[model samples]
Target chain A: MIDVRKALFGYSEWRWIFFFNKESWLSRKSKNGWVHKKRHSGKSGMALLLGPLFRSQNAPDPPPPPPTPPPELVWEDEV
Target chain B: MNRQLNEINLLRAIACIAVVVTHSITNYAKTYEPALFDQDKFITYFRFALLWATPVFVMISEVLISKNYPNGVRKGFLLKRVKYILVPYILIGLLKSYMHSEGQWSVFFQRSWEIVVLGHWHGFFVLVIFQFYILHILLGRFLQKSHPLPPILISFVLSFTYLYIHAGNKEYRVFIEQVYPFWDRTIFIGWLFYFVVAFYIGQNYERVLIFFTKHFYIPLITAVVSYVMMMNRVMDRVFVSVKSDRYDMLIFALSVFILALVLLRMIKKPNHTLIKLSHFSFFIYLTHQLTLPYLSNLTQTVANTFWSHVVILTFLGLATSIGWAMLFYESRLTKLFTGRIKALDQLAR
Candidate 1:
């Protein structure tokens, strides 16, 4: 016998998860900041894997400033 | 700021009435065998002619969205829809599940979840509309900047091809079912052409109005001819079902949409009654199914003939739906489900 519950609800949820994951991944990859940096950083694997499931909470924070920045640039950025 | 489009209000009234009529016929038809009624063929023709109803509703939504947000929507767009539209959708789904649950908790929860997620109900149009909302956010700007003709043609082909494959090919249909069950109607591919076409029309409202006004006969003629062809296909069993998503209906629906705009333009004075009906349309759409069965039972007592039953049911459905919606609209707390949000009203003007 067919599992009616899975046929009705499970299939659509799985498709939705797949769609959102693809969309968020592509969008994040195309953007130019922490999202891109986070994807390339060594800790990105688990974050990428769990991104779709906990998109809001697991959103990558802003990347820190480069340590070797010029003093003027650092002052302007601080200002 | 957008000017008040009185024509959109009238069009909303017309589409809302057509939807109620179509559902009324469906309910009455379900009560008896098709062969039992002598007017079954005519009823079929009428129902098929009104296939434009739901598609027009979808087009109206895209038109407003594209026109209102030509530069693209801000961040709060989807959030507003979730509050006004999705909340009511889920509330109604739970209400429906409760009605049919027969006091069983498991059945209630399961059915409620199915209705919420799978859209296994008459109000599945909400899910389809939600898809268009996301589509607008994603593609509306690109579509606005590009030439309309190419995208229109491409979307038409995509819509027609998808419908043909889903309806004509059983093997693919079954395969699709495995991957995305209960998505034959809720998916965007079957209705993409309407969105693309309506997006352009909404962006170029004045030019489109002038063109349609100058050549009113064009859509009128095409609407009649395509409708007749649709009826012929149905009679010949070329369409195995009486669904609105048939490939043949794409042309018919588009023509009726243009024709409606032309006809509504001829009137000078604003129709207050139609405007009110338009205001209550979304709420009516949500709650009409709940009231229709009870109204059908009441109408059956007085009307012996099939046509009389259907006509009476249609009127009662519209009236009671509007009446109940008005009662709900009177309160601040209950107004969320009525689709008459103050923000939306302000935006409309």
Candidate 2:
């Protein structure tokens, strides 16, 4: 029931992990090794793609996240 | 919390109360409202209101806790979090198992796993709390301690993504159908916006409070209007969007905001009892549904005079919920079970 596969960057437990303290930021991991995951496809940023729970097979199965709430932007354009 | 921000805890308690009722009234497993005068219709309006409670709680959580943490620390913070989360997680889980499992040793054993894996959200919100702790630590790092744009963007993008997914798949559609369905948690992407909003307000506590202060009447009027229309069957009469959780978020945010402002303005010094209410918010959340079977049975029994039953059921459910919460919290033995009763007792005093 478990797939041990981890996605390329954001989904990796280690990748994109941040230590925000200035000290940690200046450390070898944060200062030298950090790179923002970018989109080559037209899809949204990498954060949306990085759910490790969704990926895990043997891991405790979490219910899929709630459907996103819609916009309240009452644009002058959209009737 | 600053002087103005103190009452926000009251908002948290209020949100928790709304959630208590939300779960109480809407268990498809149990229907506790009376039938006449359209009980189903009343629940629809309630469905809309309940949609916002947990999210509002999450949003408030983000406000109070997310940005407050310093990013650079790792193991220490996570460990501290585990102490709060896991102790209760393990304890109440065992407690639920013991209470629910008379002789079903196998079932009792199964609940331990559920607690770890988050089987019943009705019984515990610790799962969501765990998710938020991780998000707060991780995203809190990327958030430049001041900008509001990130959450703004996160909110819109995730909303569109869900809509797109909603278009293609019925399975996805069914998952997010209800506001707080245990099977349909959308926290990962959906709550980012809320977290950001919470963080922004937490940071600019005064600005948001002031802005909310000035515009209080506007949202208040609109929410009342929407709620009245919802109850009157004026809006959405043509197409009832039971699964339309998005609007629930929109309206709930509005309601919570307006409610927050109104409560803030009215209470110069909140009753000490009200302050006491905030401490049991989590416990109250855990037990709101405990009275469901009693209320639901009572509802079905009084189905003849539906409106009167509705009134009685509402009052009884509310009282039973608060009473159960107080009893659980005040129990001397609860300290031994939750492990933090000692700690919480110290804080409460």
Candidate 3:
């Protein structure tokens, strides 16, 4: 009988998980298995305001540096 | 001492402390409104832990009534209770009305009316209990000697549904605003769940106690869990700018019952401190609100940090309330407020 009551009411404790920020780390299931999302830096201020609600799985790599302009077109010519 | 009665007294004592804790936090919060939702570590956790105070109180009342009148309520029982409960309520209500009202007769009349109907400050609970007591008598006729389980189950469903759909309804919200003196807490339908659950437990004490003892871990876990759940709701409401009523949450109502039982199990023999407080609990309730304004002043001047300020204010308010109650207890004024020369003497039994 006690087991019955526990089974019915005990799940309520799952709510305690909401208190911790540790659980805020997002993970998603993939073809292989669940994968933890790596947090990206330099989020816009508005994104910061939204906090854990808005999580991105992957950070966009830094834009490739513009080509070196063919060695500055024989540098002396440009100068 | 009867072990069960001692347990009841201890429950009362704990509930009284929780009430003081809740009011202390909130009274300060009224001035330091930011502290309650400030994400302050102490205030947030402390507030959630004691949030069950009011429901615990209502449950205790139901338990007492059910324990004493399990054979079904009678006219004599109602009369005795009414004389004790109603007389004190009226006397205190009149006193508050007199103290707070302006010189105008009309103002005095209006204030007195509000006092009786809505109760003077914390005295509103007396009205709630009075209504439930009368209902208990009427319900007894219908229930006869049947087991309390069926009604408990039925009322739980019905009351929770009533609260869920109607508690924060926009139309009634408009109505409450239109009538400024009206208090929504006086509505008995919104609080039926607490009374019903307690009544059932009181009626089936041995069985329920066994169940609680065997599954005590469940309540321990849920108490913490429910606090976290309540904090989430608080955050959600804050985020959305929606204000929820203090005692209207269904989950909160359920958790309080579970927590009250958990607390009851830990208390084997009632401590002297608890028994004394339980005796004077009502007196404390009647006087506590009067201390809030003064404590509000202290909130501004006493301490720099939110935590220290709240801590001092809580102690000061509780001490002052108890102080006044103690003064009244030894004075002739005790009879005026509580219908006895020594209020604690009668209650200690």
Candidate 4:
């Protein structure tokens, strides 16, 4: 039996979970309650954690849409 | 519609002149012995100083592309470039190959293949530019969204590393040679820094103009310092050759680029002469080498001194190239060879 809180959160801060995840321990809720699964995950777990950092931080806002056109008036020449 | 970048035209004109001068110096070196020319040090230093020319051309190309198509290029972009740039490149490559092959069909075909495919001659910049065109298409949205500083820094490192490895590592050189002989200049990695910096400048044109105006001395001092460092490296024998692809040349080129921007920004009104020269620059660049040999030979009899010969060669080279370019540009049939129809319309007015 493993303490899921201690395994996931660790003795340090929540941010330290990334460093502690090397054992590939993932906790899931089973019928019995919280069950720790020793899932052999790839680097994708770490990558998913850090992916947002590499994304564009300050993307420019999109341009505003053009104003709507006014209704056309009938002319005497057309009539 | 984008505002007219007259400063870019001025920069183009300056770059064109620098290129012509560099080629003139090279011609002098080729034709005459070192002992024959008393100004050997000056010529060498000047050549080193003008290493920024080709990179500046690359930067200008990027600046225009980024500025014009900020969102992304619409349909017919590749088609337009192929028609204007690739067509002329092939036509000129064939012409050059024909001239050099001496009427031998086999030799002509081989040379044509080398020139067009391998980028054998001075027109290798066309290959680099085409690579950037593709790169822009792929990375345009990402580059637009992200801040420019990181990309510029990253590209500089990549460019410098590639150049350094190519210059220092024998194995790497051999490997590159096995892959492509002209990889040093022809590869986009070697020139990526300039493109990234140009993208930033093009996107923030007014801001860059204002910044340069406020800090005009920054680029000027940097240019001087980098030039001195380059010359020192040459004197110390730290640098084997004075090619534009050196790691040190990247800094020097960037500084000179900024300096040129600051200096050229002072023109109150558009200089028609400079604009025309800039307009004719591409054609001039393509045809100048063809006329340079003849000009050098012709000037050799007239000018006895080193400076006189160089001056004569440069002047005649520019004159004849511009003359031919003007003729081709003005005429309807030959105007396609100039790679720009819009310039003809501008010139007409």
Evaluated with TM-score, which candidate comes out highest? 4
Candidate 1 per-residue lDDT, tens place, A1-79, comes to 8756445433343433343443455344436432222223332333356755545444576578789722110000000
lDDT per residue as tens, model 2, B25-69: 444313433331343555555555555666676667666674354
Model 4 CA deviation exceeding 4 Å by range: A1-79, B1-4, B35-39, B181-183, B330-333, B341-343, B347-349
Candidate 4 lDDT at B189 equals 87
- Per residue, candidate 1 scores C-alpha lDDT tens digits across B1-349 of 1234788888988898888887787777766546422446777777777878888998998888887788888889999899889988988778888998899999999888777778878788888889899988889879977999999999999999999898779998888778887656777899999889998998997789899899888888988999888777666656646666678889899899988887887788888778767877787778888888888889878888778988899899998977776677667777766765442354447
The superposed Cα distance between candidate 2 and the true structure at residue B2, in angstroms, equals 5.7
A1-79, model 3: which lDDT tens digit per residue?
A: 3555334322333322332222333221222333222324434333445545653334444578888522100001000
Residue range B1-349, candidate 4, lDDT tens digits? 1125888888898898888887887777777755312346676677788879888988899888988888898899999999888877887778778878989999999898888778877777888888888989998889889988889899999999998888779899788878876535688888888888888888787788789889988888888998898787775556646567678888889888888877787876888777778877877777787778788999899998778988889889989977776787777778667788456667689
Question: How high a TM-score does candidate 1 get?
Answer: 0.77
DockQ scores of the candidates: 0.01, 0.01, 0.01, 0.01
Ranking by TM-score: 4, 1, 3, 2
lDDT of 4 at B235: 55
Worst 10 residues of 2 chain B by lDDT: B28-37
Residue B131: error of model 1 in Å? 1.1
The candidates, ranked best first by lDDT, are 1, 4, 3, 2
Model 3 lDDT, residue A47, Cα: 46
Q: Which stretches of candidate 2 lie over 4 Å from their true place?
A: A1-79, B27-40, B70-76, B97-102, B111-116, B163-168, B171-182, B221-251, B262-266, B295-333, B336-349
In the range B1-349, model 3's lDDT, one tens digit per residue, is 6777777777777777776666666655556555344465466556666656667777788877887778887568767766667777787777778777777788888888877765535677777787788777777556546666787677767766655544447786567547645465556666776767777777777787788777877766766676676667555453221112243354565566665666666766658877777777776666666666677686778677666766787677667866776666566657556544233666546
